[model samples]
Structure formats: structure tokens, C-alpha cells
Target: MIAHNNMKSSPRLENEHEHENEPNNLIMKKLLSRCWEESRLLWRLAFPALLTELFQFSIGFVTTGFVGHLGEVELAAVSVVENILDSSAYGVLFGLGSALDTLSGQAVGAGRLERLGTYTQQSWIICSATAVALTPAFVFATPILKSFLHQPPHVSRVAGPYARWAIPRLFAHAMNIPLLMFFQAQSRVWAVTAISGAVLAAHVALTYLAVRRLGCGLRGAAVVGDISHWLIAAAQFAYMRGGCFPEAWKGFTVRSFSNLGAFVKLSLGSAVMIWLVVSIGYGSLEFWYYTTLLVLVGLLKHAKLQIDIMSVCLNYEFMTIMVALGFSTAAGIRVSNELGANRPKETKLAVVVAVSTSAFMGAIFMAFALIWRTSLPKFFSDSPKVIDGASRLGYLLAVTIFMSSIWPVLSGVAVGAGWQVPVAFINVGCYYLVGIPLGILFGFRLKHGALGIWMGMLTGTFLQMAILLAIIFRTKWEKQAELAKMRISEWGGKNENQPLIS
Candidate 1:
């Protein structure tokens, strides 16, 4: 009996010891899981990119607000010019810039440092050439504005000055996009973010002085924007030369021209994607403005005022989009890295975590929009019609926010997987072919105004979300990783035969 009791007690003691360590073990496991799920590695790369975007948008808002104070006519003119630039030139730049993310991320993942540098140089050359080739368009800005939309004579008068002042920004933007993407690809987001923030501060100060104090009006706003872009480009170039990206800058060669054909081939898809999405949006707005009828007082006091308020609301919405970009960027890096590293399970988990987190964030944004639906307009304007328009559209915006969250994250996954072409096609089909046309039909033809336009947009967004979700669910990460490895081998040569560099 004594022997049996001793044996039982020994086992019990062992169990007690395990129980004591169980909590500690659990804690360690939790930390590891969180690290894997959140992918701190990727966030370390994306945080700066996020900050850069935030600063850029914030400066834009401040400049727009300052111009709005000049009078509704000025605001309308600025808006029209901005819409054109966004839909045309800026869209093209951003679309091509996406190539940087894909190329650099994949090269980094495969540990091909030299190739990464080559890609960056090529990107700069291609974007710069495109910018230079496109300069003549700005000189004929008035004609282009007239061709696109009908506006007041005063509004048309401001277009020429705005476009001329904004011309230099195009080159700045061309350089900025690739440089920003280079840092993002290499996981140096913080540097980009810090530099961007400084530039934005300078921009706001200059804009205020030029517009408010110097009385330059819309021209001042345009000039400030151009200066900011140049500053940002210079800072980014300086950083690149300062050995911040030694791997990507080693022996800068003029190898860009050799890759021009391939670059254009890939960029065409991105360009079309951007053009379609932005054109759809611009077309919808134009249709509504032209078709909707209101009294002169209503047009001045209510219609125009509502647009200004919506612009502010849209600024907030754009911020949310930037935040979503953060998650998507992280997703892109994580997916590419894991695929390159031959870790299929981790890649799958990364996508799952990214999408889930984005969905939750969307829910939070929706709640916030819902709660602030009525009070939001007061932040920008006080007109009852403006307030009413905002309040009614708030719910629509919430839904959009949710859809946007899912859309961007999925886009990141596709980009990381080297599937940009197909994704771009999807965007074109949904946004331009389906969404905008329906928006015009409902908003203008049916006389439902902005609400009708939003509903049509919602339809497109939901369809996009569904398509992305389906792709995510059905994709086999392991197979994709295998294919990626084959592509890397074809492009960068054998890893085992090549000497590894520190």
C-alpha cells in the first residue's frame, strides 16, 4: 500500500509541475501566434508607406480647403482640374508604380539584390520618359477641359493657370512613385514616411502663405503642390544615394532601356486599370453635375456646398483607404516573402490573417460612419441641403468603406502572387463597364442624384469584393509558391550556384 501511494503521489507531483508551467507555455505560444498572424516583418516595412500616404493626402486636403475658401467658383475649378489630373496622368503613374512593388518584393524574397536595383532604375527611366512625353497635354489644358466637361467661363479661366502650375508636379510624381515603391519593396517605410511628413508640413505652410497671405489664389495652391512634389522627389533621391539601400543601388547601370519593352508590357495593364477606375468615377460625377437641376441659389448655396462637404467626407474616406493600403502592403510583402522562402502554410496563414483583420477594420469604420452620419456635414459646411445630402449618403459611404477594405487586401494578395494583370482586368470590368454606366443611368437619367450614383457604385464594389473573396478561397498557395520558385529560377538563375552576399 505504501509503494502504491508513493507511485500515485509521484505522478500527481509531475502533473502539478506541468500545470504550473502551463500558463507560461501558453503565453509563449500566444506571442508566437500573434507574431505570425500580424507579420511584424511586413508591418516594419509598411508603417512608413502608410505614413507617407497619410501625409500626402493631408496636405492635399489642406490645400483644397484653402482654395475652397477663395469662393465656390474657385473650389469648383480646382475640383475639375484635380479630377482630370487624377483620372489621367496621376492614374497612369500609380498604375505603373504597382510594378515596382511586384518586382522589388519578388526580388527581395528571392534574395536577388542586384535585380532589385535594376528594376528600380528601369522604373525611373520608364516613368520619366512617359512624363516628358506627356508634357504637351498640359499646354492644351483649356481645350481638354472644354472637351471633357461644361463649366462656367470663370471656372475655365482658372483651368489654364492651374494646369500650367501643376505641370512640374507630373515629373515629380513620376519620380516619387517609383522611389516610394522602392523603399516599400525593401521594407524601409519609416524613412519614406518621415521624409513625406516633413515635405507635407512645408507644403501646407507654403500653400497658406501663397493663397492666404500672398493672394495667389488657385495659382498659389497649384504652385505649392508642385514644389512639394519636387521636394519629396529630391529627398527620396538623396536618401537612395546615401547608401540607405546599398543592395538596390550597387553600381547603378543604364540597363533600363534594355527592359523597356517588358516594362511597358506590364505597365499597360496597370495603366488601363487605373484609367478605367478613375474615368468611371469622373464620368459619374460629371453626369450628375450636368444632369441634376436646381435653382441658382440652390446651385450656389446647396449643390456646390454639398459637393464641398462631400469632398471633406471623401477625404476622411481616402484616409481609410490609405489605412487599408497599409494592410494590403503588408500582405503583399508577407505573401511574396513566404512564397520565396518556400513556406506555403505560412503564406496561406498570412492571407487569412490579413483578410480577417481588414474585415474587422471595415466593421469598425462602418460603425463610426453610422454614428456620425448626421454630424459629419457640420465639419465642413452648415447648409441644410449639404447636411441632408451627407447624412443620407453616410450609410452608403459606410458600405463602401467595408467593401474597400476587402478589395485592397485582396488586391495585395493578387499583386504578391504576380497576378496583377487579371486583377486589373477585373477592376476595369467592374468599375468602368459596370459601375459607372449604371451610376449615370440611375443618378442622371432617373433623376435620383448622388444617392443613385452611390447605389450603382455599391453594386460594383460588392461584385468586386465577391470576386476577390472567391479567388482567395479557391487559391492553392502551395502550388502558387511552386510556380513562383520556377519563375525565379528562370529570371534570376540558380540560388545554390550563386554566391550569397551579406
Candidate 2:
């Protein structure tokens, strides 16, 4: 009778164990299903964004390729203009536009779609003014290059003309950047990609005709680029007015100009609540970091050849980094939208998928850089020395690409959370204080040249990435969601009954 009782107890215990494991297995399955869904949404935004970036960056890339074969002086001159001057302008404008990524995305998540059109219009006002202010810089670029920076005279002369011709593109950006953010907030990414592809195809043919077949040289290339940008902006505007976004876009309104003082204050405020100006600052700092690198390269002996080699490497860097930026853009949209929707877990999952996908893309590019180090530079140049110098720096470029892949995604996360102010500070500390100083030491003091400068900058990037990781690790997503709700409530109460006219 005792033995029979023991056997019965063993079976009961085993059955109890099975019952406990079932809930755990169910939870695991649920989590996996959510992860799969999050990944699908992320790619829907990311893949189109990636292609758009590729096409956009290819505009300059193709121009550089064409200019390179013209002569070394033309190549060097265009490099300075495009890399330093154009980059500075693009950085600030892009940064300003980033504000909309956060605001409009959150607005959509909160179901306040009407706010997007107004926010976009306000952005257009500010960005247009800023673009106008930036014009004199491009117009007088030669003097600044020669007098302040002491670039070679021939390079300056060519670059000056090119800069002047590139001015229209700035205004075009002012019109288009707002539209891009407006569209991305609503996941209208495929439209943007299609426009980019069409513009790029047209641009390639026109640029080829103007620069090569027509013998129009740098001026023609610049003019063609300017036209391409205008075309893109016009196309976007046409789309916005086509009644697809009836809920979000009720046509343009005078309300976009009302409360101008408050809007400016919010855009440029130093407080944590402010995002636009801080995003701009971060954008400027991030882009000017590379521009500063180019300046340092200019100061070196054998400046022209160094510029050529560095330019090729930088162009490739730009191309690969754009892929990461696509991921960055999607991350920003996803995180902000999820936070607005009060889904912190979904936001967290979105971050994971975005970072992982971008990292994989970066790895693929890195391997390509390593394997085809010698062959890659030929696409940009015919000069043997330029090709060889670039190839020698290939390993450094690979590392930079990988680091770039990770950090931009992290920056996107910060932007989504409205943490641009702190990240802007981080950028200054890392890129300016640490990276620039170390670069000077390595490039001039220790005689490592352009390679050393890049390595030092790479160090700064690594530090920035690590610090961002720490910040993300400690972030309270629930609190962020609360803040998003608060922000939407404050801004979403205005101009509901206004008459909007396109």
C-alpha cells in the first residue's frame, strides 16, 4: 500500500511540472510573433528609405566621377566645394528638417494628423529664411577658401564658380526637406523613393549631356544638379496637393504663420522641450566634422593629391553611410510614432530591428571595402597615385563604415526621444575636443598625413557610439511616452477650424 501511494504522488508531481511549462512556452511564442511583426514594419520603411538615400547621394557621386576625369584641378576644386561648403549647408538644413521627423511622427501616432501640414509649413518658412541667409556663403566661396582657409588658388577659382552655380539647390532643399519629413511621418516612403529614382535617372542623362557631350564643364554640372533638385521639390509639392493626405493635409493655411514668435522659441529653445534648433546644431556638428577633416587635409603638404585621395575615400564613405542613414531615418520615425502611440515595448522592438539591420548592411559594405580595396577607387579616379592612396586607407575606411552604421542609428533613437540637445553636446565633445585634437597630433606632429587624421576622427566616432549606447541602455521608455503625450496635447490644440488654401 505504501509503494502504490509513492507511484501515484510521482505522476501528480510530473503533471504539475508540465502545467507550469505551458504558460512559459506560450509567452515565448507570443514574443517571437511580435518581433516578426515589428521587423516587417521596420523594413517597409527602411528599404525604400535606403534606396532613396542611394539615389540622392549618387547625384554628387556621379558628378564627382565625371569631374574627376576632366582634370585633377577640377576634381580637387569640386571636392572642396561639395564636401566642405555644400556639406555645411546640407547639414544645418537637414538637421532643421529632423525636427519634423520627431514632431510629425509623434503627431501621427497620437492621431493628430492635422498638425503635420501646419508643422511642415512652419518648417518651410524657417528653412527658406535660413537658406537665403546661407546664399552669400556660396556666392563668395572663393574668397573664403583662399583668404580664410588658404586652399590652393586654382582649386579655389574652380570651386568658387561651382559654388555660385549650386546656390539654387539650396532653395530647392528648403522647399523639399519639409515635404520629406511630412511624408515619412505617414510612411509614404515609396512615393519619395519613386521620385528620387526618376529624378536620378533624369539627372544622370542631363549631367552626362551637360558635362561630357556638351563640353559645359563644372558650371554645366552645377546647373544640372540645381535643376534636378528643383524638379524633386516640385514633384513633392504636387503630390502633397493631390488630396492623398486629406486628413493630415487640409491645404496650406495662414495659421502656419500665426504664433510665429512661439514657434521660433520652440524651434530654437535651449530647454529639453526644444528639438528643432538642437537637431540643427547636431546636424551641423555631425556634418562639419567631416568638413573640418577636409580643411585639415587642405593644410597638409601635397594638398592637391591628398585632397583627391581623401575625397575618393570620403565619397565612398558618404555612399555607404547613406545606407545607415536610411535606417536612421526609419528608426526615428518608428520610435517617435510608437512613443506617441504609447507603445514603449513596440518602440524598443523597433530600435532592435533597425540597429540590427543597419549593422548587417554595414558589415556587407565593410567586407566589400576590404576585398575590393584596390579596385573601388578606380571608379572615382584615373590617377594612379590617388587610387593607390585611397586603397592604402581602405582598412580605416572599413572601420569607419562599420562605426557609422551603428552610431547614426543610435542618433536616430535619440532624436526620436527628443534628446538632440544632449547628443549635440556629445557630438561637440567627441568630434571637436577629442577627435580634432588627436587628429592634429597624428597628422602633423607624428607625420601620418590624411590617414592619421581619419583614424583620430574614427576614435571620436567610437567614443560617441559608446556614450550613445550607455544613454539608450538607461532610457525609460515609459517616461518618454508620457512626454510625447504631453507635447502633443500642448501643440495639437491650435487652428482646428482655420480655412486652409494651397
Candidate 3:
């Protein structure tokens, strides 16, 4: 009887254990399914975003390639001019437009689709006016380059005229950035990708004709660039006007022009509410930080050679940045949308998925940078000296590429959460206060030149990355969701549907 009872009890215990394991297996399966689903959603957005960035980047890449063959001096001059324009006008406009990524994204999540059009139009107004105000920088680029930045006179001469010619492109960016963000907020990435790809193809053919076949020189390149940009602006504008987003875009209304001051205040951040900072100037500071490297390189002893090599490296860096920007866009969209929908857990999951994907991609790019260190610069330059200098800087570029994979995503997260003001302060502290000074110290004082300057800047970038990571880790996603709803309410968003998660 005792042996029979023991046998029965063992079987019952085994059955109980099996029942416990069932839940564990089921949980594991559910987690894996969730991850797979999240990945699918993220890539759906990211792949198109990446293609859009690549296509857009190729326009500039093509320009550089053509411009490079003109002569090293021409390449150097154009690089300087491009840097200035990017740091100044482009930076300001892009930064201001980034607010749309947050605002429109949240609006969509909260089912306030109609507000996207108003925000976009308001962005256009602000950026256009800002473009007008910033026009003087292009007009007087030569004097500014020579006197203020201490660039070579000949380089400045070429750069100034080219900059003035490129002014039309500046205004084109003013119109284009808002539209790009507007489209991106709604996950209309494929549209952007298709349009950019078409424009890039046309741009390449036109650039080849103007610069290589027609021998139109720098002026021709500048004019072609202007045309390419305007084409993008016009195409995107037409798309928006074609009733694709009819509910969001209710045709152009006078209402967009009505709340100009309030809109500006919101876009730039309210000084009255210092705790909730959202300064668009963060973009300017970040852009200027990279531009400062070129500036510093120009001041080196072998100024021309330094400029050429640095420009080549910077161009590659910028290309990689476009990839990161793709991730950044996806991250920002996911975070903003999830928060707006009151799905804090999903937002957290989205961030994890995005960062993981970006990290994987970054690793691939780092390997590519390392492997093709010497050969990569050949695309942009024929100079052996330039090639060798860039090759030496390859490791730095690889590290930067890796860091960029994560950094921009965090920035996107910040943008999604409307934490631009804090990040802007971080940018100033890291890039300006720490990086620039250390660069000057290492480059000039220690005679390290471009390598040392870049090292210093990378240090700042690292610090910025670390701090942002910490912030993201410590963030209470639930509170962020609450903040998102509050922000939408402040913006007059009317939620048409109940939230799925709180």
C-alpha cells in the first residue's frame, strides 16, 4: 500500500511541475512574438526612412564628386561654403522643423490629424521668414570667411560667390524640411523615398551635364544644386496639395497665419516655462559643432591639404549620419506616437527595438569604415595626400560611426519627448564648452592637427551619448505619456478615440 501511494504522489508531482512549465513556455513564446512584431513595425518605417536619407544624401554626394574633380581648391572652397550654410541657415530651419516631428507625431497618435496641416504651414511660415533673415550670411560669406573665420582669401573668394548662388537652395530647404517632417510624422516615408530617389537621379544627370560635359565649373554645380533642391520642394508641395492627406491638409487656410506668435513660442520653447525647454537652437549648435571641425582644419598649417582631407572625412561622416538619422526618425516617430496613444510600455519597447536595430547597423558601418578606410576617400578625392590623411583618420571615423548609431536615436527620443531644451543645453556644454576647447588645445597647442581636434570632439560626443542614455534609462515612460497627453491638450488636440494603453 505504501509503495502504491508513493508512486501515485510522484506522478502527481510531475504533472504539477509540467503545469508550471507551461506558463513559462507560453510567456517565452509571447515575448518572442512581441519582439518579432515590434521589429516588423520598426523596419517598416526605418527601411523607407533609410532609403529617403540615402537618396537625399546622394544628391550632395554627387555634387561633391563632380566638384572634387574640378580641383582641390574648388572642392575646399565649396566644402567651406556648404559647412557654413549647413551650420547656419540649414541648421536653424531643420531644428525648427524638428518640432513638427514631435507635434505632428503626437497629434496623429491622439487622433488629431487635422492639426498636422496647421503645424506644417506654420513651420513653413517661420522657416521662410527665418530664411529671409539669414540671407545676409550667404550674401556676405566671403568677408565673413576671410576676416572672421580666417580662411584663405582665394578659398573665401570662390566660396562666397558659390554661397550666394546657393541661396535659392536655402529657401528651398525652408520649404522642404517642414514638408519632409510632415510626411514623416504620418509614416509617409515611402513617398519621401520615391520623390528623393527621382530627384537624385535627375540631379546626377543634370550635374553631369552641367559640370562634366558642359564644363560649367563651380557656378554650374551651384546652379544645379539649387535646381535639385527646388525640385524636391515643389514635388513634395504638389504631393501635399494633391488631396492625399485631405483631412490633415484642408487646403491652405488663413488660420495658419493667425497664431504665428503663439506657434513660434511653442516651436522655440517658452521662456516663461524654463522647466519645459524645447529650444530649436539645439540643431544649430550640433550642426555648428561639426562645422567647427572644418573651421579648425582650415586654420592648420597646411590649410589647403587639411581642408581637403577633413572635408572628405566629414562627407563620409555625414553620409553615415544620414543612416543614423533614418533610425532617429523611426525612433522619434515610434516614441511620439506611442506616448500620444498613451502606450508607455509600447513606447519603451519601441525604444529598445530601435536602439538594438541601430546598434546592429552601426556595427556593420563601423566594419565598412575600417575595411575601406583608404579606398573610401577615393570617391571624393584623387589626391594621394588627401587619401592618406583620411585613411589615418579612419579609426576615428569608425568610432564616430558606431557612436552615431546610438546618439541620433537618443536625440530622436528626446525630440519625441519634447526634451529639446535640455538636450540643447547638453549640446552646448559638450560640443562648445568641452569639445571645442579641448580641440583647440589638442590641435593647436599640441600640434595634433585634425586627428586631435576630432578626438576632442568625439569625447564630447561620447559624453553627450552617455548622458542621453542615462536620461532615457531613468525616464518614466508612463509619466512621459501623461506629459504627451498634456502637451497635446495644450496644443488643442481633440482625441477622437480612447487610448489603447495607459
Separate clash counts for every candidate: 1, 0, 0
TM-score of each: 0.83, 0.95, 0.95
lDDT tens digits by residue: candidate 1, 1-502: 9999999899899999999999999999986786674666555655666677778766666776688767666765676556445335665666666766776777788887677776777778877877887687677777655554444455556767788788898898788888877777777777778888999889878988999899988888988988887888898889988987776787566556665555555555436555343322221222222122111112232345545545545655666777787888888888887787778878887888888878988899889988998986564444566567668778877887777667778878877887766665676577656776777677668766766666776687677678878987789888988977875665555452332110
Candidate 1, run of 10 with poorest lDDT? 289-298
Which residue segments of model 3 deviate by more than 4 Å?
1-10, 272-280, 495-502
Question: Which numbered prediction scores highest in lDDT against the true structure?
Answer: 2
Q: Global lDDT of each model?
A: 0.69, 0.86, 0.85
Candidate 2 backbone collisions, by pair: none
lDDT of 1 at 103: 63
Local accuracy of candidate 3 as per-residue lDDT tens digits, 80-140: 9886564467878878887777889998889888888888888999889989988998999
Positional deviation of 418 in candidate 1, in angstroms?
Answer: 0.9
Error of 3 at 467 (Å): 0.6
lDDT of 3: 0.85
lDDT rank order: 2, 3, 1
Error of 3 at 366 (Å): 0.3
